[model samples]
Target chain A: MKGYLGIDVGSVSTNLVFLDEEGRVREAIYLRTRGQPINALQEGLRQLAGRLPENTGILGVGATGSGRFLAGIIAGADVVKNEITSHAVAASTLVPGVQTILEIGGQDSKIIILRNGVVTDFAMNTVCAAGTGSFLDQQAARLNIPIEEFGQLALQSTAPVRIAGRCAVFAESDMIHKQQMGYSLPDILAGLCEALVRNYLNNVGKGKEILPPVVFQGGVAANAGMRRAFEQALGWKVYVPPHYDVMGAVGAALLAREKMAGGGSTRFRGFGVADTNFKAGGFTCENCPNLCEVVEITCEGEAVARWGDRCGRWSGSLGYQDEEIRNAV
Target chain B: MKVTFPHMGHMWICLSAMLEYLGVNVVVPPPTSKRTLTLGARHAPEFACLPLKLNLGNFMEAAEQGADTILMAGGCGPCRFGYYAQVEHAILEDLGYNYRLVVLEPPRKHIGELLSKIKYITGHNSWREVIKGIYFGYQKARMVDDLEKQAHFLRPREVQRGSTDRAFKRALQEVIAARDPQDLPKVREKVRRIMGAVAVKPRPVLRVGIVGEIFTLLEPFVNYDLERKLGYLGVETDRSIYLSEWINDHLFLGLVRGQRSRKEACRAAAPYLNHFVGGHGQETVGSAVIYARQGYDGVIQLLPFTCMPEIVAHSVLPGISNELGIPVLSITVDEQSGEAGLVTRLEAFVDLLARRKGVVVQ
Candidate 1:
């Protein structure tokens, strides 16, 4: 009944994945973050605990995402790794011998080039939110259609309009202008998908050799229209693994599995932690001219972690909560 | 005249000590921060490079502190750095700072011209005193460089996390507070011992060379303390560009007595890049090849967003990487590169290098 848990808390969503001992996913939960990760995590954990079988044992937990440090502290994870590692790990595992990984998540998109199961190069979009899932969501809302339906609508387009995709602002205006120019919604939606994929290839995937056996994951990969565009853009078979949306969480679980030897126990705080009260607070440290804002998290009324200090004045002073024995120690 | 200049890493520490020693009143802008970047970005042309914006910000801050003169360095290049001084001067004048911008341009035209420019700061000091002041600055720069080098080597392997950083910071303070130039070498020796004395486990790890534009590579604020992030991930880092090395190569080449090595680096870079695109672009490629051939694990190219030279370097790096069989990661940062994203990429890079070698990162 023992299983490993992995959590990924990104700006747009929180994903929780449970894996059996054989490294196969048993359960996956993806929920909106809504700008508050703690609530989403707690709620996600609660739902997960409720769904588990009686006497089910959770062995190890791993966390990854933009909120990984905070998520790891809260989840009491055995390993805390970045989204890039998690995504790369998950993609490589899904498609053995994956040469490239294209992940376009809620807020950011990244290109990971791998060789022989090791990540060799990566690039994230710079300072512009042009080709990400959230932008897709925004466009869907403006188009007055459910985001889930938007991608399918793109598939119906007879001739997709060409929308400028260099910048997000430009893309939106172009989409509106196309809508006014009598282009069908499906055509416009398909055009938007193509624009985003083009943007991804030009910027994030720039200079990276797009070798075959490419695996595309992340929240955006759920959009079949985007997947088709990628296949055309790269002229290679783009494999969107079965669990496209929750790859980061799955990868984290796999990493946790690797970290745990047969006898090594996990740092998992147990499913009961879902009921525990966790509060986070922050204050700017005025001791120096840098004025660093140091944030601390309290679990059951005890300061467990501190971060965001330029010097170790704050983070070093506070006691960490069951920090990973070997990760970033 | 009370003098001030833009800050680049710890350049101010050495420059302040040297200028004060030469009897010129010095005004240092507040150490660069979010405020400085904001002020610079607000005032700078949107298309200008990050360093220019930062310098403008520093100059504005220094001017507010009643510094009447801007002592700046000048460059001539296909890169935009050489144009920084002139544009910044115009901006400050338009803002009515009433400051004299004294540029210490490179002596590509005449060595005497450079001498005359430096002579203004020499004042009533004897020629011996001027030489003494220059030597003193050189010693401090060399010491800082050596101490930093030692810390980089030790930090990844240090038994105590942040031990080398604390010791190095303490040593730098001693250097900054040093009243006599003669006290520099002793400080250097003492600090080197302290940093080198850090207890280390000496585990073999991936070695990464940071190759890119000079400003972004040296200034921790701009690159978000990249070296430390790599070090804590258990990776050893060596920078292709150092402020002291740049100074030695370009400004005081004769004093340091290095001519062959400069040509050697260019030659190393020549195979992949054949010609200099501008700034450190050639060095970035050359250093990667050098690191790859030397059997290093990988190279990370850090550049400011929209940096022309580094953009050229980025395009050429993968080809070199493919040819040499060493991996390269190019990280471009602007004002908005969040800490989480940068750290994630760095960790993933370290992970990649370690895994490729069949080494598990602890």
Candidate 2:
């Protein structure tokens, strides 16, 4: 059996998905990043190795995430894409009519406004943690509730309290105040859920024409409480796809499938990538005052890729080695 | 040789003082007056930011006055400041300026490369002297900054009773005449004494944070002297585009790795705001939060029209205001931005904040 593998290593989570030749997800693994993506990818690959058919040939491999550049080096990615493009493609593929996507991941949150399956406007909140899964995890911990049970607690709330959802500090104080007033844990949890949803809508969704067929993905979508909150706030049905957590990887695999079907040869390094020795080294380029700190990845002393350059100087310098290095594998 | 340094708000004053200490003749383009804007607007690319245009104008004016060298700083980041030096160098060269442009890239993973650039620019072969020059330069910059911040609070009230510009000019002249750091205290004392004598006003004023596109925020011509205009309307401004903040964020933050100062910035801004609203929205949130807490009437966030980071901040600010119960007005200005429209918005935002705070406009 021939198949494709996709890997997404974000700051918060690492996801790996396998798709058959027809672009159907055969299996997917989602693992917490826990500060190290290398180990997570290895473990994810080990699980996939167990699930795949014996003697299955991995036809193509693609990677995307904040760590896409790093993952591309590790997985020998045939294609690499930014999270925005990857998420939009995945959501569009799942809903076919997805006009808006609200993807709140473990560390970052992004709102993508789409018109006719094309992304028109998008904003990413990478610098703050207020509307992210990490924030929810922290709140769940503060409430002494198991993170897994948070959504269930929210679901049980008959009347959720209204807490200030703007800043995390105010939200925490408000949550504590409600708790002091003898509000039920479920009500507080639901309020926290609503606060997060309201914060996301007010911040990222501001002035945006967020139409229907809205798809919510990322790790946050796993929470039923958040989904309910979003539905209640927007007055529209929000769809949570079955494979919400690993949509980025799934989208990468889908993109690879489309590219491969276009008659162009796949640049995938194949399953043997797991066996390759890759090393990354960085050096400062003092060619001009814009001293670009360039990072280079080498496979057995041959430079495979170079990035982290501000100017295209270093990358442009290595343009000659592209075909030679790609053909070497 | 006479040299010119791009004005990074009050940092240019420090740079000038440092340059003077080095025995280098420093020519600062006059402090962002109308003529500076007229010259910048006439010469700058329409899409370029007001700060860049203003600085370019300053540099041009200085160059025309026989300044033979230009010193620019460099960085590597998502912020366009990293590329400003290279682009400005090309633009200046295109204008047929005969001056040599010296760009000093911040020392990143490599210290040796940074030292080389420093040696090249200062024309001082000794590393110790280069270090000392920077040390003294920083001291002078901080002193200048300290005085300028005081001026922001004092200027509007002094001007409210008339002769505000006169008071500021006299204070700056005293600061400029100081011989060294020790003399700064006396200079500051004199300025304070002068400001103390100026009549003070008792009405509440709107406080706005001018942020986004470093050039636009600092260059008066680009924003059409928005700060002065705001002050004229009894508005107090808190701008977050200080060179110190930029240096702390871009350079020092990285040196102390794993600390996540961006998160810290958000947390610090939390009392005033919640979550990152995008771009420098955190700073906008910080300013707004601080303004509201400090009893400032309103917060105005300014960005060059079409600037990506400010746009992101603008989208997030309305929600911030909604939550904080503080009013925030977002102003995006480009070449075509009308002075009349900006004045109208500023007047409305101030009135709104005053009404919300129950401050009677006397």
Candidate 3:
């Protein structure tokens, strides 16, 4: 079997997807990053390798999300794209003619507007992460409800109470106040969902013309309450794609396939990279006043990649003989 | 008196040259860095824009270097910048830093006061020599702006990465070194030769207009080196404000030179924003319209977080974007902005622009 591999190493969750030659998803894996992207990426690749048949070939690899550059170097991706473009590509492919895409991931949320199957405009939440998936996770834990059951509980709400949703801190305090007022758990949960939806629409979705065939994806898309809240706010039906949680990965896989169509060899280091010992460390360069924090990644105790220096002193110091280092730089 | 001023792009070159030519002891604060921002942000009011914080940081760093006086520009408008000097001075006094702040306000009818301040800073330079120094400094600013314009044009087209930037640095150093008025033309020739040495690929490039608050537009440290980033993404950037232009418009030089005035921008913005909203807000709106009329690929609004004027402009920009059929992106920079996040947004914006132009970007 031959396919392209995509890895999206986001802040909270790392997802991997494999797409076969026909651009169909073959495997999907999601795991918690837990502040250690390297570990999560290797674990995902290992799991994916185990699930694949013997002699499976990865024709190309792509990486996306906040930790994309790190994932690209580790996975030897042929293409590295930002999450916005990746998500747009995924939504447009999965839900054809998706005019508007609302993606709420672990740490950030973004609104992508498409026209005639092309990305026309897009915006990501700026200076605030109040209404993302991580906030919901924290709220669920605070209420002593399993995160998986949070959406179901909200669905059972009879009268959803309104909560402040301007800032995450303010929202949390507002929720505490409502809880102390003896509001039912389900009602409060549903209210929190509505508040977040309002915030998302006002902030990230500001000035965006959201015509329907709207596709909602990302980790928070699994929350039925959020979906319902968005539908009610827009007064239109919102479609959550089947692989909504891993759409970034899916987009990366599709991008990898597109790149491979040019007839070139894949730069993939292979699934065997799962067994490689990868170590990452950082050091502050005091040579200048910038004091850039540089991160270096080592594979089998040899320096494989270095980045994060604004002046390029450390990033350019390493040899670029390796294709991975060349592309990463 | 050892004089220091905040950095705003290459304007310092002209300022330091003018002061040094008048035999004034000038101290240039260390190049803006994270430490400078951290020092400034630590003491600055949390809600103040990034420029004020950076200005505070500049003064502190200069104070450590034995600077006894700070040179700052002043303005009067609805913008918070009118109060920055006073606020920064009070903050420094609270921190027990002994320094005198000499602000040069716009000389509408107060030309005498402006001259007296300049005379005090220059210590004992004759009036004739002072005027000569001022003219020389203005010319130097124009030259620097010209050099920067060329760099922006060549950055995207340069065959080798970093070639244009390296050449720009060399040319700028030459401009700074050519202090004597007679040596100006020699510096100009050298700048042209140096910039010309950068081989260009001669490819069609996407043009982007940058307009917003003066500080954010002029200071790369606050805006995450936006011009360079756009250059790397193969986009040519045209900035709406330059030091020489600001000086020309405010110092009555524009009338003397018969140059294009801010009134033109105001007229262009009249369709969308009829009234002055303060700072460069009107100019930001006008520049987007100008760029759109010129058939540019996109317009990017760079504003410091909480900038009152640009915030007003930001609200009105989407309408201009939709009406003009040009993509507009508003980016706010503050202490909390992450480089990775900025890069991602920039790449996505460039991707959007490229796709709209039917150009395939890897």
DockQ (C-alpha based) per candidate is 0.60, 0.01, 0.62
Ranking by lDDT: 3, 1, 2
Interface RMSD to the true structure, each candidate = 2.5, 22.0, 2.6
Q: On residues A1-329, what C-alpha lDDT tens digit does candidate 2 reach at each position?
A: 88788888898899999998887889999998898766677677777888888888777777777777677767766666567767877899878989999999887788876666665556665224686888889988887888889998899999999988888888989989999999999998899899988888877776667889989999999899999999999999999999999999998787667546646456655555555666677898876533557888777788877865543466646764433222211
TM (B chain), model 3: 0.97
Q: Write model 3 residue lDDT over A1-329, tens digit each, in one string.
A: 99989899999999999999998988999999999999999999999999999899999999999989889888888888899989999999989988999999999999999999899999898889999989999999998999999999999999999999999999999999999999999999999999999999999998889999999999999999999999999999999999999999999989888878888898899888888999999999999888999899999999888888887677767756233433432
Q: Which lDDT value does model 3 have at A159?
A: 98
Q: Using alpha carbons, what is the TM-score of model 2?
A: 0.52
Least accurate 10 contiguous residues by lDDT in model 2 chain A: A320-329
- Give the per-residue Cα lDDT of candidate 1 at A67: 85
Q: What is the DockQ of candidate 3?
A: 0.62
Global Cα RMSD, each model:
2.0, 22.0, 1.8
- Considering only N, C-alpha and C atoms within 3 Å, which residue pairs clash in candidate 2? A167-B274, B51-B215, B51-B216, B272-B289
Single out the weakest 10-residue window by summed lDDT for candidate 1 chain B: B254-263
Off by over 4 Å in 3: A319-329, B255-260
lDDT of 3: 0.89
lDDT of 2 at B331: 69
Scored against the true structure, residue A184 in model 2 reaches a CA lDDT of: 95
Preferred candidate (TM-score higher): 2 or 3 = 3
Give all candidates' CA lDDT scores: 0.84, 0.69, 0.89
Per-residue lDDT over A1-329 for candidate 1, one digit per residue giving the tens place of the 0 to 100 score: 88889899999999999999898999999999999888999999999887879788878888999988888888788888889889998988889999999999999899998888878788887677888988999988888899998778899988989999999999999988998989899999889889999888887887778898989899999898999899989899999998899999999998888778545788788877778999889999988666788888899998888888887888877534323424522
Candidate 2: what is its chain A TM-score? Answer: 0.88
